[model samples]
Each structure stands twice: as C-alpha cells, then as structure tokens.
Target: MELPEPDTASDDAMDSFLDKFQSQPYRGGFHKDQWEEEFEKIPLFMKKAPSEIDPKKNPDLACLQSIIFDEERSPEEQARTYKGEGNDYFKEKDYKKAVISYTEGLKKKCADPDLNAVLYTNRAAAQYYLGNFRSALNDVTAARKLKPCHLKAIVRGALCHLELRNYVEAVNWCDEGLQIDATEKKLLEMRAKADKLKRTEQRDIRKAKSKEKKEQNQNEAVLQAIKVYFEDEDRAELYQVSPKSTLLQVLQHPRYSVKALTPAFLVCVGSSAFCRNYFRGRKVHQVK
Candidate 1:
C-alpha cells in the first residue's frame, strides 16, 4: 500500500499563527485583554488531537518551546522531561516514536548526525518487527552509510539478509559486521549456521561421489578375481593381449632372467602352458 503524501496543512497553519506574534512582546499572540481567555483555552485544547495542535488555537508549542528552550527551565528539568517522553515510548515498544522523542531532546543541534543514526536504527528494528523486510533493510543500510561502524545496523542488516534467504550475502554481511563487533553472539551464530549448511551440502556431494567410486571399484575387483578363479588367468590374459614373435623372443631369450620377464611373457606362460596342455590332452583321449 502506498503512503499518503505529507500534509502541508499543519505547516501552512503554523504560518498564520506566527504572523500574529511578529510584533508581540510574548509568544502565544496573547494581548493583555486575551491572556485570561487564552489561559483557560490551553487545557481544553491539550486534550484534543495531537495533529491538530496550532499555536494560534492553544499555543502549546510556543509555551513549551519557550520553557524548554528558554533559560527558564533548569537544565536538569529539561533533560528529565525529554528523557521521560523518550522512555515512555521506548517502554511501550513504540521505537519509531521513541526515536523521534530522543531526537527532539538532543540539546546540541550539531549532534543530529549521530542522532539520525540512532533513530534510523531504532526505526529499522521496528520495521523488521512489522515484517517490512525491504524497508528495514533500507533503513539499516542508510544508518550504516551514515555511520559505517554502527554495530546495531550492521547486525540488523545481516539478519535481514538471512531472512531474505540470501545466504551468501548473509554470510558476507555477518563476516564484515563481525569485524566491528567481534563478540556479537547473534552474528556469530548466524555465520555458524550458514557455515554448517554449506558444509552439509559439500558432505552430501562427497558421500555421493564416494559411493559411486566404491561401486566402480567393487565391480572392477570382482571381474579381476573371476578371470583368475575360472577362466585360467593366463589364458584370459593371452586372449586379451596379442602374442607376436616378441613373446617367443622374451620367453627364450635366455639373456633375460624369468623374474625379469615382461608382462607378455607372464601372460603367455600362465595362459598357454597349463591351459593348452590340458585342453590338448583332453581332446586326444576323447576320440571315439
């Protein structure tokens, strides 16, 4: 859903309120005759809608700003009031409101850059709770960009990446964030989980490969053992290999010792001598 454009009516209304105070000695645009009437009106208007607040109607901002910003209120009182508002919303888990309260309370106007980072981080967390992942990610990114070392924003950004199922990105973010807050337990856990998942996947592939290799090796070993046990290992090797004059040369070339025999000689002796004699003897005696 699209949000409505910001209403300018409040600011426009404020302009009219300020015009009446231009030549006034005090704010609230109240003259001597109007003071009592305006005093009675403030309490009634304070109970009305917040967005409807107009200095012209009730003059709370003017009065409050005067007391809060003026040298009138003790510094401690001013601080207590600001902290009270911020703490109220913070305890209520209204982080967006708390952030605004805290921001407005910063007495040092030059401190806004740091304050903005805190506000952005708080609102990002609230957005995350509201299931606005993209908005949360944007706020965190902005906060980090403003203050690159913001540990909260970095951790939150990594968590958002995890929620989004961008595991690689999540791991990368956590890795970078860990540099800033090395003791961040949550980030460590997230990176550990991602690492475990990656290792598990690799283990599965390795297991599959090992199973295939085992099957292949078993089949090869069985074939070799079968040839040796039944088919006369010698004769099978002789048939598989060509026996040329090189065989006779290697076998009778007495210059070479039998232990030094080539693989061709071993095959010829193992297959031919035993198997050929047995077969020929069996055939000759079988004449009928």
Candidate 2:
C-alpha cells in the first residue's frame, strides 16, 4: 500500500506552531516595571549600594566629622565624642570600626596631651584586637611619647610585643610600666609570662647544643680510635703474625697479647687484627 506523499505542508506548519508556543515569554513571574516601582520606595541614603560608598569619602563619615569638628564645638568635647563612639564599637567587638572612630578622634588634633595619649592608647587596643601587633606597638609608642607615665599604653605595648614573639621587648616594656606603678597586677603577670617563655626557649637551645656536642664528641672519639689503631707500632706488629697460626697460638704468643686496655682501644685493635687475617685467607675463628 502506497502512503500518499505525506502531508509535508501540515508537518511544517505543526512544528512552527510548537516552536512559537514554547518560545512565548512567561507571564507568571514579576515584571521589571513592578520591581522598579518597589525599588523607588527605598530612601535615597539607603539606596546607595555599599559598592557606591567610597571608604575615604563616605558622606556619612564626612557629616560625622563636620559635626564633631565644628568651630563652635570644643576640641576636647569633639575628641571625647569620637572616643566614646570608638568605645561603643570596641565593646561590641567591632575592632576595625573602633579603630576608625579612634583615628577620627585623633585627626581633630586636640591640644590636651592627656586626651591624645588616651586616643592613641585606645587605638592601640583596637589594633591589638585586630591582630595588628606591630601597628599596636606603634600606637602605644606614640601614646608613651605623649605621656610617659600612661600605664595603659605601657601595659598594651608589652602585650603587643608578647604577641609578636619579642620576649625581650615585652620584658622591657613591662619593666617600664612597673616603674610607674609597682603594684600593677597586669604588668606583673605579663612580665612573668614573657620570662617563662624566654626560659623555655633558652632551655631548648641549651638541650640542642648539648646533644650536638655529644654527637660531635662521639664522632671524634671514633676517628681517634681508628687513627690510634693505624699509628700504634705495637698493634701493627700483629699484621706480621703467620696466617697458619692457630687461634689459641696467636693469643698465647708472649709479645702479642696485652691486658688492661680500654674497651674502645681493644675493639679498634681487634678490628685491625680481623682485617689482617681476612686478607691473608685465615678464618676469623682461627685467630681467636
């Protein structure tokens, strides 16, 4: 039975229909226009994405600086405000933010050395929490330079050095702090820790040196034994003993055998005798 040439036209038309049907845009999802309308409701300040906010030129930060640094506001008051903000952040464990606030307070450049010292010390605390030990040390140094007797800065400096594995520097800083307040418990504790670590490090070094020396001495002793065996004339005479001599005959020889020698010397001389017998085709047991 011959099928009619097959309805090519109808087949092409059906495929076109299926393709267009599937290709139509889905109407079930929210449209771009609806999303745009919702987005417009957000406040302008809140609408600025994090990527749009420049760290160095943030508008909120600029506004904060303007308020604090106003000519009408006392410098001391401004510094205190910034310090308080930093303290708040520090209490929240936001150390990087605390550092920023403390730094802003310092930028005010207040005339009071005590206030500046406090600011520097506070920033050092933040830096320490952030694991910037070297930076913390630097801040503490600045604080100390401004007020030599600042106990907090001195203690913080010691702690920073301890974190950096600078035991000697930590001890020195602790000593400096103790000079100002002899009964400071924190300084005493830090000094003790540094001293203990230093002692442990020194003990390890001494042990390593002792082990190395012992090994070197053993090696030298072995070399010396070999040298003496080769150089001693009395031992060298054993080489002239006849290969045909029995084991007991060698030992019984009047001039060859000796007594009261050290174990190491005896071993060396015995090894030489064994080698001489081995080379002359005498069994080792035959020369006992």
Which candidate ranks first by lDDT, i.e. highest?
2
Report the lDDT tens digits of candidate 2 across residue range 81-154: 88998998898888998899899889889999999999999999999988999999999999989999999999
Global lDDT of model 1: 0.63
Tens digits of lDDT, candidate 1, 131-211: 777777988898887799898988888888877766677788889889988899988999988667657767888999999
Cα error of candidate 1 at position 272, Å: 48
Quote each prediction's TM-score: 0.39, 0.54
lDDT of each: 0.63, 0.76
Give the per-residue Cα lDDT of candidate 1 at 241: 22
RMSD from true fold, candidate 2: 21.7
Q: In model 1, which regions exceed 4 Å deviation?
A: 1-87, 95-111, 197-288
Q: Least lDDT summed over 10 consecutive residues: which range in candidate 1?
A: 279-288
- Which candidate number has the best TM-score? 2
